[model samples]
Target: MGLLVKGKWYDKWDYNNDEGEFIREESQFRNWITKDGSAGPTGEAGFKAEPGRYHLYVSLACPWASRALIMRSLKGLEDMISISVVNTLMGENGWTFEEEEGVIQDPVIHADYLYQIYTHVEPEYSGRVTVPVLYDLKQNKIVNNESADIMRMLNSAFDEVGANDKDFLPENKMTEIDEINEKVYGTINNGVYKAGFATTQEVYEKEVTTLFDALDDIEERLEHSRYLVGDEITEADWRLFTTLIRFDSAYHGHFKCNIKRIVDYKNLWRYTRELYNEPGVKETVNFDHIKKHYYRSHKQINPNGIVPKGPELDFSLDK
Candidate 1:
């Protein structure tokens, strides 16, 4: 992992805090793209939705980035908003589009590295360069880099341009969806990273325990409810889906989140396959990219960088 220091690249991976907990950096580009070029819930305005006017830079290996890709596919926005997937392995250069299998080189800005795109938006930008970035072609600026916000944008922002009307964030379940998102985001989504990147054993134990506790809670909830919010698949379910899909393959081993594999949870494993089988969902998942990235990228964790090949997954769901 690396970050840009005032438009300059720096190879670094010090994400731990004084307490040895891995703290995720807040996304710097918070601007939004609304349907009518109006200001969104939390950003400047004038980023109106338009076909072939926006692009996405993402990494299939990243759960956060995968959320945006899933939404784009689910909402039928593939042709509306274009995407360029970076290489799976994040090395010293940090999220490059260099020639590699399953990698789609950046065709918009033609940048070799993702940080170059960030610096192009703000020459002196200072922050961690992350994926799922929404860029405006008309305005020639970064609309938003936060996955949650981008998901909402793709849900409704381009409806006039022939995008799907399936509302992932419905009005009635807003409160419940937000509440579930909070818990899942804290525990399951970010929890694995916190555990894997923890500098001390105490922090790792605390995070891993909290992570499994959250998973157990969700497993119990899924036993009764078809989805996280209810019968309808909401933003909450998709948000959790990205992390769950990668749990057994990467987190369980590479992240040392081996308390149990996601397959060990009866309801969750079934639920995962159900979602995976959902139309347009499976296409977004690339296990080769996911495994290679986590295992090979983090040299501090696995210095030898040997990718594992066991723990075969069965993504089949019973009717």
Candidate 2:
């Protein structure tokens, strides 16, 4: 994972602490897009939700970025917002706009690397150059880089601006959704990383165990409710879906989250299939990019960088 240091590129993959635990970098840009150009829950104002004024940058390989992609598709914002797809392999230069199959060129400013977008916004910026960036062409600044925030904004902000009025995060279930999001995020969403990137065996074992425990809990819960919160699909389900969708393909073997394949759990297997069958939702998944990035990008994990070819995943397998 290369990062920008004071606006400069540094090719590094270190994410461990003294305790040998993986530490994910926090998102830097926090601005939000709202209907009235007002400040969001935790961001500044003026990033209005308007058609043809915003652009999205994402990597199909990234789960966080895929969250925003899924929300965009679910809300029917494809025509309202534009997007650029980065190359699957993130090398020394970080996320690049390299011309490749399934890769869309960066139309805004025609920058080569994703970091250029960040540096252009703030020349002296310092942080990881991540994707699923919401750019405001009018202001020429990043609206937000946090996937959760972007997902929520896409769900509601653009409704008045021609986006479909489907709210995954309903007001009545906000409290319950937030609570589930917290648990799922820590133990399942980020847990695979903690286990895969752990510098010590102790950390890996502890994280892997906790991850399976959480999966077991989710498996139990899915037996009762079709969705995470209730019978109706919500943002919580979408949030966890990104991670689960990639569990068998990337996290299971590549990230060492092999305690159980999602297919082994009857309820989770069925739920994943149900979500994948959602109209417009399946279009967002790119298994080719997902496998290549995890196996090729992380040199420290797989020094030879050999992408795997087995364990064929059929989302419709057990449904």
Each prediction's TM-score versus the true structure: 0.98, 0.98
Candidate 2 ranges with C-alpha deviation above 4 Å = none
For model 1, how does the per-residue alpha-carbon lDDT over 203-253 read when each residue is reduced to its tens digit?
A: 999999999999999999999999998999999999999999999999999
lDDT of 2 by residue, 196-273 (tens): 988788999999999999999999999899899999999999999999999899999898999899989999999998
Least lDDT summed over 10 consecutive residues: which range in candidate 1? 310-319
